[model samples]
Target: MALIITDECINCDVCEPECPNSAITQGEEIYEIAPDRCTECVGHYDEPQCVAVCPVDCIPKDPDHVEDEEQLMVKYDKLQAE
Candidate 1:
């Protein structure tokens, strides 16, 4: 599943750079995750880097964007393709 930043986000900017897919971005107030670009770090790491670094644990899985591991891997490859 794609991860989402909740309203609990502090906008501290800590989780933005930790995302391997560059899926996280600064929003008007809280940070937002681009679901289309988010692969949950499937091809880059064992776990989601943004969730690992977030101090408030505001990142949570988006139930609306659920996807399988194979789908995530394919998204990751597409993101890194040149």
Candidate 2:
């Protein structure tokens, strides 16, 4: 699943640079992750980079877009292709 930043985000700007897919961006108030671009770091790392860097622990699995490991890999491949 793609990770999402909750309203609890402090907008510290730490997670943006850590994202390998460049999926995180500054929203109106908090940072947002593009679900289509988010592969949960499957292609690049063992774990989600954003989650690792986020101080507030606001980033969490996107319950609305759950996917298995194979699906995540496919998404990662598509992202790299683009």
Candidate 3:
């Protein structure tokens, strides 16, 4: 599943640089993760980089964009091609 930055985000400006896919961006109120570009770091790391660095622990799987490992890998591959 794509990870989401909840409202609890403190805007620490940490998660943006950690995203290999460059999916995370500053939103109006908090940072946002683009689902199409989010692979949960499948191709680049063992775990989601954003989640690892977020101090608030607000990054969570997008319940609305659930996906299995294989699906995440496909998304990761697609992102790599771009």
Candidate 4:
């Protein structure tokens, strides 16, 4: 599934650089993840780098944009080609 940054985000600025897809961005209130670009690190790593580095543990799977591992991999491959 794609990830979403909750309101709990402290805007620490660490998560942005960790995203391989460059999907995370600063929003009006907090960081936002673009679902189109988020593949949960399927092609890059075993775990999501942003989740690993976020001290607040505010990053979570986007239920509204859910996708299985295989689907995520496809998205990752598409991103790599761009």
Q: Which candidate is the best by lDDT?
A: 4
Evaluation by TM-score, superior candidate among 3 and 4? 4
Clashes of each: 0, 0, 0, 0
| Model 1 residue 55 CA deviation in Å | 0.7
Residue 17: error of model 4 in Å? 0.4
Q: For residues 1-82, write the lDDT of model 1, one tens digit per residue.
A: 8999999999988998998888999999889999999999999889999999999999999999999999999999899994
Give the winner by lDDT: 3 or 4.
4
Model 2: what TM-score? 0.96
* Quality of model 2 by C-alpha lDDT: 0.92
Candidate 2 regions exceeding 4 Å error are none
| Candidate 1 weakest lDDT stretch, 10 residues | 73-82
- Per-residue lDDT of 1-82 in model 4, one digit per residue for the tens? 8999999999999999999999999999999999999999999999999999999999999999989999999999899999
lDDT per residue, candidate 2, 1-82, as tens digits?
8899999999899999998899999999999999988999998999998988888899889999898989999999998888
| Model 1 alpha-carbon drift over 4 Å, by segment | none
Candidate 4 stretches with Cα past 4 Å from truth are: none
Whole-model lDDT values for every prediction: 0.93, 0.92, 0.93, 0.96
